[model samples]
Target: MTKLYASLALGLLAAACGGGGGSAPIATENASAPAPVAAAPAAAPPADSTIDCPMFPASAIFNTRIDDTARFPVHADNAAWQELVGRATPFTANWGTSSNPSDLQDYWGMPFNVVDAAATQWPLVSFDYAASGLVFEASYPAQSDCASSADGSGVVRGCTQVPASQRRFPFPSGTTLAEGGDCGGPSGCGDRHVLVVDKAACRLWEAFYAHRIAGQWYAVATASWDLRSNAMRPDGWGAADAAGLPITPLLAKANEAASGEIRHALRVTFRDAALSLQHVWPARFAAGSDNPGAIPFGSLLRLRADFAIPDAWSPQAKAVARAAQRYGLYVADNGADLHVQGAPDSAWDPAVWQQLRSITMADMEFVDTGAITRDARFAKDSLQAGW
Candidate 1:
């Protein structure tokens, strides 16, 4: 097995950094400004209450309500997407019921403690956020020439406008960017990653298996998303994540915690539990084993909608609970069973946060995903003209 820290670096980094990998200081200096791109209209919420399982009133990332009213061929109003709702399954240990002698570590096993959130220490992946540079660096991609050697070297080869089919926003020239993270090292620490944020344009770019050698960034895979749109990763493509999804939208940010409700689904991990390196729709990884019962990467596990929340629970705990019941949790990586993620915040009460452990697999059910992967690559015109 890979080092636990290494295995964790991917999911945690995405949560901490942009897309995936580890924490790092987002470049505060302006490298290149991007042209302003009008934000896409929110996907109109569906009038059919039956199809809208989790009522995400707005785009969790962009602060715009998705127009659930419009039909999203990808998921929102898709018949295949609706079919997965209420698909029930008891959460098994490691997503399987074998009950073998396992010795995996759960990152979320420890209760929240002040020491855990000490500023000097590297915040765990769950706690990393954009404000602190733990998550994203609001900058632009670099404008430089790429050598053939740079293609696979994990080095930043300068910023180029990504193809419309590949990117959701217009990438301006002269954006500064890099790859890789070092959770244990300086600003960008942990595993390899790539990050690009166009503040002026309100966009983000990221990649997995990112690298940096001699102050240059490189990556095996990269993706871009418009902050304003309720866009989703194409069904079968992995975006810096084995799950083929964006990590930022799924994180439990401090603001959300403070709001007394996490409006979106959160990310979770398991102990070396991936089905494979190549994934299914919503997942880009393959099956880890032949076990048909194993939970694949990107599988959505949701708390029963009918589950009741205790009034005694703290605001943070209740917020998390509400999200689980509403949006559910997405399996992002392999490590610790039933370990949900949370952003770092010194203000969080340790005792209150510990209550999150009270939540368990017993409270959730695996969402059935039947035709999740049916869609092909997203066409440039799939969204509105401005997006």
Candidate 2:
């Protein structure tokens, strides 16, 4: 059975209070309105520079610490997911140097690009499998035009939003896609995700199954978000990841881990068979099997608070363990079970990564995100009003 949360009571009080009391009025109609706002799209939190790029507002769910049990609600399906996902499965760190430890460049994890200044421009070709109805901004000085046509899958796609970004990302010719290597996949072999953090614009752009062909780029789906805003994809829309979540923020970066603390949740993946076809708040698209009580996309899996981080472990490993206990992990994509995603760096000590492998699903539990999502006004949104 699902657990009840105080957040629902707070929602009632917030509604009964006409929400007139709080200053964070995302939107308001008549104060005496008979019912709370329908599941209408809520206004995004105003964007600003106080927080770094790729990190949403401090109040956002992704950045908030779930260790504060009072402020956030536990999801109803927590136990069900754990029973299905199992507690003894060991977690894997998906970043580090493999076979050729002598070769610094030989490592795993997706390649992420940071854009702080000028770069060569490449045309943003139409998508082959974008989530229908989502709007994307177009390039300012229009990109080189190409005939919109069928992709390798023979599915036709084109730009929908006329004045938005993302359809035109900031990759120079020959830029590598996610998972590395030359990105000239004319027919698409892998996910080939491309992630960019545009600090100047305080925006994040991500594309899935991206292909760089003949100096132009095309993708199956794309998502662009204002780092400062609480904007969320409409329910059931897919992005670079299946959970409709951003990829960069969830990664456990080497620099951040070496600093001794990672403040946000990390991303994890599971086999398709362990995933439920249904999704939870903030997760727009649902894929995988429809097994009853199976884990859903966007489920929060936290390291049990009692699980001690061995004192002898490297600071990097200890830091990740702490975050798993605090902010937790979000089921983001379909892949190996309990695979924890991280940023690959030369600075990473493979020994430290090896220590992290000791962590298993048995040391974790699911968090009910119901209360954190109470304020969200749309099925697709995960925005939460600031406390």
Candidate 3:
């Protein structure tokens, strides 16, 4: 009966939350209010600096120590927390599951990876104000693009009042559909995620189940982030990804690759029913599963701090290993078991990439993150006044 209830909840949750498999045709006309005038492009970063990379504010949730914040709602050293990690099944690269990819590269693939800056090479189709113009709709907590509407299948179908600074996502001017949505297979129809970085503004916009019709952008869910703050997504809300987490901050950035170490945790995935209802802080969902031993979303899995990086490893791989030992990896979504995320970069060595598979779940320990506590007021405060 427990398994049966979880199964039903899973099905209902998917429909309510805009699961990756479905799609609706783009609408030429918007069903919501119009967007505001475009804000001036954000001030460009200094010549020597990159806007989004290079510097992550100390306050950013990714960079913040779990023990440092007054907002940490969980009691990290609780016995329950320790027991959770000790008993929960651990998955690594070679887990013999049908959905688990054999290689680390295949797991994240296009969901993230650096795209070439060249305009013509951008694969996702692009539209401008002069052409099929884009639309911005303000999403509400109850009437969210990713949540169920009063009707059904809570997908955002129309446009509302969104700002150009927020919605006029500076997708690479020549960005084309990389691979997703209509471009992917029926069962595996990718989320058709659209990510736009306003370098000048130092902001990021990401969407899931995205589509462009008559030049207008549409999405089932969207999220925006300020590159400067360590703010978190509201509890119980969904972001472009199912984890209700930000994707860019979690990614292995090009700058980090160049610096030879990732300072933050890598975003990872678990198959459905392998997640729990109690998300650790920094994560917004306690994505439910039938497995009693499933790790809660936002749980931190760290490689032993003193673990040695093999001498044969490349500098880039070592940096990643160092990060695992330091900041650790955070469970962000439901997908394959233990797949770490990094943006695509041609510079990656195939051998270096493969070495990541060597660092399995066994080499890691679940950090003591205290105990889980729910505060409705805190959850509301984390939300944007308007999306």
Candidate 4:
């Protein structure tokens, strides 16, 4: 008979306290009763960087370990078990009355225990968020006590027996699997086993404790849950998890920000590296603009300078200008083209200039040649304030 594990029965719990506070109202004195009183303006919403979003406590982050020895039964009618079977089956195949034996054997090897079993109901066991690193302990009670038998009509039958053991397999370690690899590969294999319980021809199970690492809300560390017994096989598991996996909004936002920052940093670093190499060649400067293969360091420098200037041009402009002067060579043309001396046009071209414009405009209101030549101190402060 097919079985489901208790670990699959646990529900994902994501709780945060306190609704957003409303803006305070402005206060004014009564005209006739008292002296005039100035009203204070409402505070602006906090910047995305400064906002203190609630985070799951470290304790809650690693919950679900308690069910280490817990046992659970499986029944045909269990919702979780049914979900498991549905996921296990290939859409192209006709999943008839009997399940594949290899699949069943794989399920039995999972790291969970079977607690109880009956025809009408199945109670799966699992840990809370605090005990496990979001891994569920599952078991099938019917299979624990059932003995296989054959009926006279060429059909198979089984009688349920009581379970002798209620021990749980060890939890899988995160390091066991490297990112982007099969579970059976050198990096993906883990010492932990998973248990499943099936009853009423359905899989009833729960998963407990899922965690979001600090500074990485979207990047979650979850226990592996595979309906297919041979989840390590390339054919058993897909390239990525299905749509059912839960995702939090905070995680999504953080990921978006991180991606942007990475792209920005990469562009900046590439430009810096190219400039360092070009500064050593003096002959390349005299053979400017006409030579397509020649470097255009001056134009490149000017473009970077333009990108550093701020739209508001406050006291910060002087510092930004200094940074630009240090790294960039200016052509003095009406800010048209940038030409790095030693590096060929292929290294820094119009496309590069466009990219600089886009990144600077999006991140900062304005950028001038002076600002780009200045030291990094002014640029750092401007960026921190969201420019």
- Candidate number with greatest lDDT: 2
- As for TM-score, the candidate ahead, 1 or 4, is 1
State the lDDT of candidate 3 residue by residue for 1-387, as single tens digits.
112222334533544676455554432212343322222123222211344442235423355343322333333433454354343334332211111222333333433322223321222222221333443322222212221221112223222332222333334444333323134321344545566544543445566545556545544555655454434444566566655677766666544655776666677776665566556666765444545556777777667645678998877778777776666678876766766765554445556556766775556666654322233223322321111
In angstroms, how far off is 287's CA in candidate 1?
A: 6.4
Off by over 4 Å in 4: 1-14, 18-116, 119-197, 206-387
- Stronger candidate by TM-score (3 vs 4): 3
lDDT of 4: 0.20
TM-score of 1: 0.50
lDDT of 2: 0.60
- Which 10-residue window in model 1 sums to the lowest lDDT? 110-119
Error of 1 at 290 (Å): 5.1
Q: lDDT at 66 for candidate 2?
A: 86
The residue-by-residue lDDT of candidate 1 on 157-191, one tens digit each, is 23233221122211122322221112232343332
Assess the local accuracy of residue 306 in candidate 1 as a C-alpha lDDT between 0 and 100.
Answer: 59
The residue pairs that clash in candidate 2, if any, are: 74-368, 75-368, 87-362, 137-164, 137-165, 138-164, 235-380, 236-284
* Candidate 3 accuracy as TM-score: 0.61
Q: Which is better, 1 or 2, measured by TM-score?
A: 2
Candidate 4 positional error at 124, Å: 8.5
Residue-level lDDT tens digits of model 4 in 321-346: 22233222222111112211110111
TM-score, model 2 to reference: 0.72
Q: Is candidate 1 or candidate 2 better by lDDT?
A: 2
